[model samples]
Target: MDEKKIAVIGAGIMGISALRRLSENKRFLLTCFERNYDLGGLWVYTDQTENDVYGRKINSAMYSNLQTNLPKQLMQLEGFPMDEKCPSFPTHTDVLAYIRKVADQCDIRKYIKFNTEVQLVTPVSENTQDTKWLVTYGDNRKKNDSQVEVFDAVIVCNGNCSIPNYPMIDNEKEFGGLVIHSIRYRRPELFAGLNVAVLGASHSGMDICHDVSKHAKKVYLCHRGSKLPTFLPANVTEKTSGFKRFTSSSIILDDNDIIQIDAVIYCTGFKYDFSFLPEGILEVGQNGVVCNLYKYILPRQYSTIFFMGLMRLYILFFPYGDHEASYIKAMLEGSVDIPAYKERIEVIDDDSKRPWLYNSHWEWDKELAGIAGNFEPFQSALKKIRDHVLEVKAKDFSKFRLDAFKITGSDSFEIL
Candidate 1:
C-alpha cells in the first residue's frame, strides 16, 4: 500500500491532536501549517488587540483575565491529563502549557511548519470520484513566496473563532461610538465609567458583561430571551429584546424603547469561514452549518478530505477533536467504511431537528454537532461529563472555579 500525503491546515488544539494521531501511522506523511510561531489557537492570549503585531486583524478572543469556564478534566485530550494540582478552571496560561506539554510528549512538533500560513486548498480533479488537493502555503518570513503541495488528504483544523461577524443593524452607520467585536476585547478597563450595551448573551457575552461591569458605569446585557444567570454584578442589567436599530446616541429595541449608551461591545459571536476551500467542494454558511458533509467528516464528494473542530460549538473541543481524528484515521486505514452518499444525507437530515436558531446556517442550521461523539463508551463518557459540568455549574456558578472532577472511567467520573 502507498502512503497517503496529508496536509494539516492549522497548528491549534485540533491540529495538534491530528498530528499526534496521524503521525503515529507510518502509512501517512504529514505537513502541518501554523500561522503563529506557536500552537494553542484561540486559547493563546495576546495583549495585541484587533490585530497581530504585524497589524493584521487579531482573531483570538482570549482576554487577559479569562479562565476556562469548562473544568480541566473536560478540556483534556483523551490520553493527556492536566496536572491535578492545577485549578479546575485554570488560567489561560495553564491551558497553553498543558497543550504545549501534550505536543511535546507526543513529539508532534516535528510535523508542523511554524510561522507559515495556508492561503488556499483547491481540488486537483473536478471529478467526484477523485480526492486530491493542491495546498498553497507560504512562510511568514518571505513575502510573495509560496509552494504548492499535492496531498491525498487535507485536514482543516484552523479554529472557528478568527472571523468576527459584525452584524447588520439598521441605522448602524448613524451611531458614533467605539463599536468593536468581541475579538478585539482585551480588558474591561477600556469601558471605565461608560454606559455599554453588550450584544449576544451566550457564554462570551455573559462573561464579558461580568468582567466589564467592574469598570463600566453600567452594562445592559442584550439578548433574545435565553436563560439569564442568577447572579450578575451590581452594575449589570439584562434586556430581553434585541436591537431593532441604532442611532448615534441610542439603540432601539424590538419593543420601541431606546437606551442611550457610550459604547457597544458586540459579544455577538463569530462566523466560521473557510474561503480558501474551492467552490462547490465545501459549502458552509456564516453560522458554520455545512452541507454535503457525511458525518461532518468527509464531504459527500471526497473521502480523503476531512474537517476537524467544526462540530458543536458548546462541547469540550480537545476531546471532540481527538475523536474526530481517530475516526478519520480508522477510515483511512480501511478499518471503517464511508457510507453511501444518500445515507449520509439521510443521517444529516435526521439530526437537523434540533430546536435552536441557526444564526449561521441561517435556515438549515438547526442540526446538532452530535455525530462526532457517537463511538460507544466514549459517548457514554461524554454524557457523564456533561451531567457533571451542569451539576457543578448549578451548584455554584460563582465558585465553579474551585470545583474539580476526575474522570474515573470511560463512562464515569468523581468530583474532586
Candidate 2:
C-alpha cells in the first residue's frame, strides 16, 4: 500500500501513544495537531487564566495533589515501564513527563504541529475514495487563521475532557454562590474557611472533595445517586479522614430560606463537542457523543474516520482510551478487520427514560479485548497483563526493580 497521510487531532496522552504506534509503520505519514504550544494537552501544567465561558480565572492544569487514579504499572505504555523511583500511583507530573518522553523518543514531535486547532473535518465523498477526509485546521499564529490538509484517514483523538457538561439543576442561576465545573477547578484554596458543596461522584469529584475538605470549614460531597466506589482500592490511612460523601439531589436551604452555599463545584464529568462534524456524518447522542458507532470507533455510515478515545472504561484495569486508539490504528493499517458497529454498541436498560449504551471503562475493556481476539478468563487476563509488565521490566528495568524496594503497582493486568 502507498504511504498514507493521517492527521491526529489533540496531542494528549492517547494522541501521543497512537502517533507512536503509527510511526512504527513506514507507510504512515502522520501529522498531529495540538491547540497548545506544548505536547501534553490537559496533562500539561499551566497557570491560572481567565476562562471566557465561565467568566473566572482557573488553574487549567495543576492541582496540589493530582495523582493517577490507575496504578503506574497499568497506566504506563506497553514498552516503557515506570521508573522504579516513581510512586505506586504516579503523580500527574510523572505521567506528563512520561508522555513527553514518549513523544520525543518515538520522534513523533517532528510530525506534530503545535498551536493548531482542527476547525472542521469533512468527508469529501462518503467511503468512495480510500483517502476519505479533507481536514481543515485553524493556525493560531496566522491572522486569517485557516489551512486545509487531506488525510487517508483521520483519528479523532481529541478527548472528552475538553468540554464540560453541567446538569440542569433547578434555579441554578437564581440560587447560586459560586458555580464552577471541573474544567475551572485548579485548587481548593478558594473554598477555605467556608462551606463547600461538590457535585458528582466520579474520580474528579472525589479528588475535589479530598482537596476541599482539607481547608473548608465544612465540605459537602453531593451526588444525585449513590456514590460509586473508586475502581482502584484506596490507600489513604485513618489519620486523614478529610473526605466524606453524601447523596442529595438538592441542597438544604438556610434559615433565611436562601439556597446558601459558599461555593458549588460540579465535577459531573464531560462530553464530546462534535458539532464541527456534519450532522449526517455523525449523530450526537443525548449523552453528547456520536451514537451510531460501536465501541465508539467506526461510525455506522462512515468507516474512514474513527473515534479513538470516546468510551471511558477499564478492561484489564487500564484506561480504555489508549486501548481504543491502538485498535483504531490497527484497523486503519489493515492489520485487523473492522467489527460490526450496532451489535457491539451494547444498549443497557431499555426501560429507563433515556436508553444509554454501556460504555463504562470495564465494558470498553472487555469489548476491545474480545475484538482483539485475545480473550482470556478473568484470572488468566490478570496473569497475562502481569507477565507482559514483568517481561518489559526484565528487559528495561531489571536492575532497578531488583536493587530498589519497589513493588508492582497493580494486579489487574489480566483484564487488558
Candidate 3:
C-alpha cells in the first residue's frame, strides 16, 4: 500500500501516543506539530518564578507536591511497563520523562516538528477524489511565520487544558490579591501567608487545594460538591489486576458561602478550543466537544478527522486515546467497521454545577472501563483494550514508579 500522509497537532501525551501507534504502521507517513520546544505539554516542568500571565513569578521547576491523580499502571502505553524502582505516585517530571522515552523508543521524534503551532486545519473535498486536509502552521523559528502542510488525515490531540475558564462572578473584579487559572499554577508559595479559595473541585482543583493548604495560612476548597473518586475501580483489578487509589488529606469549606480565601485558584478544568476550525466542521458541547459516534471515534460527517483525549474521566481499565487510535488505524487499513450511535454527546446545563460532584474516581474508572469495551469477555475486544492499557502503563511505569505504585497501594487493589 502507498504511504498515507497524516498530521497530528500537539506533541503532548495524547498526541505522542497517537504518533507512536501510527508509526507502527509502515504505510503511515506521519508528521507531528508541537508549539513547544519539548514534548511534554502540561506535564513539562518549568520554573514557577518565571513570569506567567498570572503576573506571579515561579521560583522552582515545578511545585513539590505535584502528582498524577491516576496511578502509574493505568497511564502506561501498550508495550512500555513501569520499572520496579519508582514510587506509586509519579511526579510531573517522571510522567514527562516517560512520554519522552516513548517518543525515543518508538523513533517518533524524527517525525515530530517541535516549536511549530498549527494555526488552521481545513478539509478539502469536492466532486473528485477522496477527502484530504490542508494544515497551516505558524513557524516559531522562521521570520516568514507561515508554513503549510497537507495530510490525508488529521488527529487532534492538543487536549482540553489549552484554554482555562475563569468564572465571571459579580464581585470578581472587586476582590483583591492574585487570581489565577490552574494552567498558571506551578506552586503553592504564592498563597503563603494568605487565605486561599479554590473553585471547580475536579482533580486539578483537589490538587491545588492540597498543595496550597501546606503553605497558605488558610485554604478554602470551594465547590458545588465533591465529585472526585476516593479510590480506583474494582474492574481494574478483576481485569488486569493492576490499579491503585490516592486519597487527599483534607478539603475544607469556608463560612462566607465562598471558601475563605485571599487568593482564588480556579482549577475549573478546560475545554476543546477548536475556535480555529470552521463551525460546520465541528461542534462543541456545553461541557465539552460533542460527538455522535460510539466512544467518540467517528464523527457524523467528517470521517477523516478523529478526536483523542477529549474525554475527561477516570481511565483505569482502558486508555481511550490508544483505543481510539487503534480504531482509526483499523479504519485506515480497512479492518474494523465504524460503529454508530443515536444520541450526540451534550454538555451539562449548568457549567458551574459539578456533574461529577458526588462520584468517586473509582466510579468513573468502572464507567469508562465499561464503555471502552474492556470488561467484555470476547478475546479480541478484551485483548485490544487490555493490551493497550497495559502497554501504555508498562512503558509509563518503566519511566515512573509512582504510576505503578498508585495502583498497588490503592484500596481498590485489595478488593479487585
Q: How many residue pairs clash in each candidate?
A: 3, 9, 40
lDDT of 2 at 214: 74
- Cα RMSD of all models vs. native, in order, equals 4.1, 8.2, 10.0
Candidates, ranked, lDDT: 1, 2, 3
Error of 2 at 355 (Å): 11
TM agreement with the true structure for every prediction: 0.89, 0.75, 0.73
lDDT of 1 by residue, 144-211 (tens): 86989999989999888888888888998899987888988998899999999999877788778888
RMSD of 3: 10.0
lDDT of 3 by residue, 44-152 (tens): 6775534544333322224556876555655666678655564556677787788888779888889888867788887787311246888989766565588777789
lDDT for each candidate structure: 0.77, 0.62, 0.59
- Higher-scoring candidate on lDDT, 1 or 2: 1
In candidate 1 the C-alpha lDDT for residue 168 amounts to 82
Worst 10 residues of 3 by lDDT: 237-246
